[model samples]
Target: MDSDTFVYTTYIRTTPEELWKALTDPGLTRRYWGVAFETDWSPGAPMVWEEGGRRTADPGQVVLAAEPGRLLSYTWHTFTPAWADAVGLGHEVYEGLAAEPRSRVDFAIEPSGDTVRLTVTHGGLAPDGTIKELIGEGWPAIVSSLKSLLETGEELPEPPR
Candidate 1:
């Protein structure tokens, strides 16, 4: 458990190929997380993020690795004013996030007999940064919803604001 990184592991009753589709397919992602990423899923490909009708794109927002059903990693989205406003983040909080160095998230998938082990690692965060705090509460819910969607063909209801 590194202070500057967030790691989450879960086992889902699905094939590696299906799990990979859930992670990369915009439709699947939008179902679990109200976010859609537009990219070719190749290393160095730029990613355009669409969330709540707001689009965020940056040169640094790129895929670092893509191994189909094995591994996928990419730089996190840029914290722009529009994104913050759309998500109801205040000006001060948005400024604080924009000031921090961009972080990267990696999704590793492995076959464990009848289930697939998915490990999500979000790294390069400030030890005590606001992003870390927010993601700490955010990723679990998102991952749980993802698991539900994959296993039961339905996503969990959105959490209250």
Candidate 2:
């Protein structure tokens, strides 16, 4: 895998619809992943994330054209005033939501036995060391938390041991 891309797969003892809602619903995502997704979930809709003092997906952000379920694509980051005024080509330490450019999130759900396997692929990130490393480390914890939430109906106090 390229340093810019990180792939994570998790098996949850749940149905596809359950997994889909868990992945798509912003409320559910916030509980498990600690990020809030804001979008109408329609094709050509802007999916934005508001965290800290910065808000992603402003001017020049990609708009989702169609969002049925399981797949979400949005212009992740555009040249914000802060980013544009920054000295370097990039300002954010990481990419995706901020920092470097290029961002998209693809989530797929498949059936396995009585459980659903969720595969999350985040790509289009700037090919940088920090972005790659952070995604690699962050994905596992998020995936594990999702798995625990689905199985036990509660967030795990700690990442899977």
lDDT of 1 by residue, 46-77 (tens): 99999988889999999999998999999999
TM-score of every candidate relative to the true structure: 0.97, 0.72
lDDT of 2 by residue, 1-161 (tens): 45666678878899888887877677778778765667776666666765433556664554454344355455554545554344243444424335566566677777799987777787877666555666678778888888888889886565442
Worst lDDT window (10 residues) for model 1?
1-10
Which candidate wins on TM-score?
A: 1
TM-score, candidate 2, is 0.72
**Model 2 superposed RMSD (Cα):** 5.2
User: What does the lDDT come to for candidate 2?
Assistant: 0.66
